[model samples]
Target: MWSLALLFGLVVCTLSVPTGRNSPAFAIEETAEWIRYEGYVAETHNVVTHDGYILEVHRIPYGRFQTASTAKRPVVFLMHGLMAASNCYILLGPQNSLAYNYADAGFDVWLGNARGNKLSRRHEELDPDNQKRDFFDFSFEEIGKYDVAQMIDYVLEYTGSEQLHYVGHSQGGTAFLVLASSLPEYNAKFASVNLLAGVGYQNYFPSLPLRTLARLTNTIYASAVALGLVEVAAPSFFRRGDDDSIINAVPEDEYLSELSTITELLRDGADDSDNSNMFGGAALKQIAHFGQNIRDKTFRRWDYGLLENRRVYGSVSPPVYDLSLITSNVTMHYTVSDVLLDERDVLAMVNDLPNARARKVAREDFSHLDFVAALDAKELLTDYIIESTVQIENLRSTGK
Candidate 1:
């Protein structure tokens, strides 16, 4: 009976549910509730970028266990991976969440939502619904140049700090590399950077499914655009499974039953309320850009085809991002089981960095999603993050 139910649920998710815009509007409210439930104070702030996109940044000023002496703590900025928002860090709930762990350790934790995600979908001059192309014309290049830069500046100015510790996962790490390579002036702004399951070079990908999908990305994106759908959404299994906001949007009993069925296959110890909300929305161009990286095996800017490349870049080929420009003290964390990023690719990325250290997860079976959703993630990764931050702080104080 259980096996039949699980199979049925998988079939339903695979066929019926569409990705992207299926989430509810109460994401912010649910986020607030999750933070407070875990004994942390949550503050939501809107950041307006120079390019006119409005982003939502969440802050945990202090934790319940914090003391008055730790009032003005060192700031730590945490950015999520592809198709994820600030919710990724808090989805595991307070006890196991990285954001809460940072706050408990006396660091002012700020979660950034990149442009076009659920939280940062508004623009100054263009409406997302009315001006689809203009509103969603960016890839990670723009994210690195505008969103990351503006968020770092806002956090620094708001905290009155000269430098803050940085932590990024996957595309978050990619954006940091892009920022350091393009805007080298920001190198001094980070005390230390910890990249988890990050991607730098795409010369090799381990997942057969991903590789196959990459090959078809251009075709799929073109078809979607022709069909009047410009926004791409990740599959539902890639996100949180227990978000109350999504639950509130559906019939409680039916939602719970479906949730149980879905989790049977993608079990990561998440509760029924923990529905996947990883994918908000991404531009068609952004999807194509990642596909290009996978196909070209080079971490370069978007290819505007040959004709447009000459006009925009003065060459037929897009210029490769110079990884050597990233001089910040950096540490990379990867697991052997991550299907998207192979060990060789990660080693290649680390080899290019001027100042870097590499750490592998102890668990041989620790997969990509495990970094955020595994039951033992706190012990396997979050503890290491806390310890590394302390070490970085010590090094800064001693001027090492």
Candidate 2:
């Protein structure tokens, strides 16, 4: 009876129209609603970083089906990719959601939203709206340094665990790499690190337009910053539309066919009507940092031009992030069809890391977005994540 009721409720929720507002209020409410409907425990915590940005974190201590146990469970930290918040992990619903799967497996799950996104928009002294430049002054470097470090420390303190497992998608993985490389001491805090379609060296961005944009990113971002537009939506130019936009530019038949293909890849028979809300705002500098990586073909700190670079780093160019400093067990998962991150870049990253291995996704058609939204992600990605966790536990028990 309960199962039938849940099914009915799900159908009702799916049939309802999602709100079109792109505010944090809607995102928070939607996340909470889904958590309750799925019968999961939702806890929201505000973590203040050393740099003054306040990040909003979401946690699912355990699945609804799990019984309360006195034994402390291993904790897993899941971070979202570029232009996405912690809600991405939970957007796929309970049966296929990575967060729910981790909780059901008896692992404590924590999801982190990077700064400038809807969830982590607050700061100690700066207002995001009025003080645009100060609010959005950071790039992925700051995210890795302050945001990731603080969240990990808070989770460790909250869970009373000596070490935790980390699973990062795209920029999430990049931030972890930054954290591990820049702050080598934090390497001891992680039992293992899993990077899903994570990129470090990005010389092979598959899209022609993106490659072209990378060349102009510095100019574009600097102009935007100068114009007092710091907080901007990533890929904001091509969201959804019935005319003029990329989606509308395609003919009706071709667009429908393409939509079908994408829907199949992401939704995998699940409703995707609410996916529009998943995308949020990010710092312009963050996007520019990625562009810098593409143009320079090196995973290094953000370049503030030659003059400013010398002022900041005492060098004419930014220093490269030393991947060798990462001593934690690292596993990378990539798909051949990921346009954003090329296989060559992934190989280059793997070659740099002292303790790293790379695995290609099972499907050749898997794209960058599939890591989070694919229907078969459980078999292709989540299983590997679970296996990695088990391996970490076994290694710990063996004193290795």
- Give the whole-model CA lDDT for all candidates, comma-separated: 0.72, 0.74
Model 1 TM-score is 0.82
The 10 consecutive residues of candidate 2 with the worst lDDT sum are 1-10
List candidate 1 segments past 4 Å from native: 1-29, 65-70, 233-278
Across residues 336-386, which tens digit of lDDT does each residue of candidate 1 receive? Answer: 888667788888878988998888999999977777766588999999889
- Candidate 1, residue 358: the lDDT equals 84
lDDT per residue (tens digit) for residues 157-221 in model 2 = 99899999999988899899999999999999998899998868877777665565467667766
